[model samples]
Target: MRQWLFALGGLLVWTAHFFAVYIAASLFPGEPLASWLTLGLTLVALVVVGWLGLGAWRVWEARGEDELRPWLGGIALMGAALSAIAILYAGLTAVFF
Candidate 1:
């Protein structure tokens, strides 16, 4: 039940990110930087959402399994690493540009 909820939440997050990007691009077709900003934000959001969805899937897979701890740990680690990279990129982009 919890796993399903988490998966649903991840799906919602993914959908929301796409919708936001699409709306931004559609509404500001002629604005400079609009597409770039939308793409950048969408990329970041999608990566984060993918990590979360992967984590949720891992949790779902681990529910009744005995040897799933390692996989779950790996998922968490991967998610954290990706998030860190995204943060680093955003910070650098903000500072330099």
Candidate 2:
């Protein structure tokens, strides 16, 4: 059950990320971002997603352990932090770039 829950959350995160990129590209089709800046943003997004995958892996590995709270809490905190950072980056990019 815990495994399934983590799997579902990961899938949802992936789907959201896909749509987010689509929406961003659509909205900012003609922005003046440097090629390197664009590449860097892409890399940052990948790192955020990678962190999510790591969190999911951690939860899955600790499923049978008694310390599930720490795993879940850390994942939640990381996810929130990633999301906040991404959103701030996007807003700043659109506003100033």
Candidate 3:
């Protein structure tokens, strides 16, 4: 449902970005186009993850007495952080190697 999607959005975006970068690298090989595409994807992914993290932050702050909501928000926030790290690593590798 919507809740589940929100919780997993970071991981989903990370996965998609990873695959897209991989595909671009494969398609372009050593071409500069591949590096450019990876850079663009990395920037997009960072922005999206940041937005998702902000949403999760709001959810976490507004959890109040809802224990489940807080946990969901924390998980989402952590996932977003992890996804951002992954995206950065993949982007750098694709661009440099």
Candidate number of the best TM-score: 3
Candidate 1 wrong stretches, greater than 4 Å: 1-4, 63-97
Model 3: runs farther than 4 Å from truth? none
TM-score of each predicted structure versus truth: 0.48, 0.39, 0.95
What C-alpha lDDT values do all the predictions have?
0.55, 0.54, 0.93
What is the lDDT for 20 in model 2?
60
Tens-digit lDDT track for model 1 on 1-97? 5534443454455456556655766777767566576657656765776677567556546655556555554555454445445544543343234
Q: Kindly provide the TM-score of model 1 when superposed on the true structure, using C-alpha atoms.
A: 0.48
The lDDT ranking, best first, is 3, 1, 2
Per-residue lDDT for 8-79 in model 2, tens only? 453445455545655666666766543334445555555655666677556546655568655664665455
Distance (Å) between predicted and true CA of 30, model 2?
3.5
Model 3 poorest 10 in a row by lDDT? 58-67
Candidate 2: regions farther than 4 A off: 1-5, 34-41, 60-97
lDDT of 1 at 28: 78
How many angstroms is residue 62 displaced in model 1 relative to the true structure, after the best TM-score fit? 1.7
